[model samples]
Target: MSKKILVILSEWGFWGEELVGPLEVLQSRNYKPVLCTPTGRRPRALPPSMDPGYKDPPLGKTVATPEMAEKVRRLDDPSNPYLANQRSLKAMLPERPYWSDLGELGYPDERGQMKMSYYPLRKWEGYCRARAQAQQALVEEFEALLLVGGSGPMIDLVNNYRVHDAILAFKQADKPIAAECYGVACLAKARNFDDPRSIIWGKHVTGHPQEYDYRDLAGVLDPETGAMLSREAGNPDRWVNFGPPFYTLEHILRDATGPEGGVHGSVGRPHSVIVDYPLITGRSTADSYTTGEKLVEVLEKGLRRYGW
Candidate 1:
């Protein structure tokens, strides 16, 4: 039987192409990949930011092509058996909301229903449930875990106790794990660098550079609850903050100082891109292809050595 790989996706919005790219590579190698979300139901993709607007190369490049987007939509349709199975790419989209519906915050000036800014003031019910499901799935199936990145990650994965718990459980098992961009933020919650229990402690990994976060307006928040997206309408802040930026670099810098030291440095002058064992990470959408390529190589090498 092929090795089972579990992919965790956030329902918030557009997942980077890297998520799909790595899965494709794994399938080509005959690895069985399963997509799990907060809920077993189909999750919606965040609409392309560039749609019905300006058409540019880089923007067009990152946004899902109409065909790709359409395929995802079809998978959500009840009749799509390919998506009904656990292995379909659509299975990875998160179905359940991490928080209760808050109802429309307000209507957009243009049209469409207004969306909620934050979870309906509930503490962490939705997140807790989702985390339990993800952790249980990881334990019952899958030899490896791949946490994909997207703007939604900033809201759902970072500092969220459920995500923290899932990572903790998988790390304890010593399973091969990989993440990129906002997905890397999940590692920060694993605790201190010296704690053997911490998955990121000594591992070399890369994620959205601080520069990218700031440039993209990552952590800025609304005046009301101090939440990141409470202010925006069409786009919620949940996909922006990925938890306080403080948590992002805290564990990373500590790990970089470890024995490997100089082997891991910032990717560009601004200092993006970091890597460590059993873990491969990247900066942002720009680094998706390279990130996917590296992850495949890592998994292949590991499988070869262990005879998987």
Candidate 2:
């Protein structure tokens, strides 16, 4: 049987190409990739370009492909236990209502549905809920986990507890946990039971750079907190941006050892890269191919190590 690989997608739409590219790489290698979410329903993909006025657009308007739509639809089956969970689905919904809330300021909706407003960061409630659901899912199913990144992850992945749970579970299982771009933040937030600092206290991993967040012009502006979500999500002491310009250099951060001995994380850029054992990660959308390739590599190596 093909190896079972589980991919967790952000309920908020993603940058269409990011998930698709990596998924294709996995499928080509005969890896049985199963799609799951906080909810099982097909999650939408955000378009490559966002309208200045914030009008949501459907897949038809974006670079989304027919094959990609099929994969999403296949994963969307409401019958799937993952999607059927009410708590997870509710948590996936964005804190702010999509473009409709803009009223007069909203962009013209000549296309199908009004484009939903995409946020750079997720609401704390939504983030927490999804994290919970994802953690549970990882425990019950999946031999390995892959967190595909997009702007949506900026909000949901960082500082989310469920994300921490998933990483910890995989670490405990001694399975490879992989992520790319914003997904890498999941690694950054991992908790170290011994240190109280972070699970990834000493692992090299790459994420959407502070510059990338700044360039995207999509960082959070919390009316309540009055601070950017990214800034709040990161260690206040660290010089990371919650928003964009998304430079490639600072994007790869690493901490290779914890108080305990285990190879934690490594820095990677657009190119394909891998860190054997425990975790595998990539830099950006450009690195999805490498990320997928490395994930399979780790799994295969793991199988050999265990004499499976």
Q: Pick the candidate with the highest TM-score.
A: 1
Residue 30, candidate 2: Cα error in Å is 2.6
* TM-score for each predicted model, relative to the true structure: 0.58, 0.56
The sequence of per-residue lDDT tens digits that candidate 2 reaches over residues 5-120 is 66766655455456666777778888766765554445545433222223222111233345554554444444545333323423433222232333322221233233332332
User: What's the lDDT for residue 246 in model 2?
Assistant: 36
Error (Å) of candidate 2 at residue 116 is 40
Task: List the RMSD of every prediction in angstroms.
Answer: 12.1, 15.0
Q: Ten residues in a row with the worst lDDT in model 2?
A: 51-60
Q: Candidate 1, residues 62-93: lDDT per residue as tens digits?
A: 44555555544554445766433544322322
**lDDT of candidate 2?**
0.52
RMSD of 2: 15.0
Q: lDDT (0-100) at residue 216 of candidate 1?
A: 33
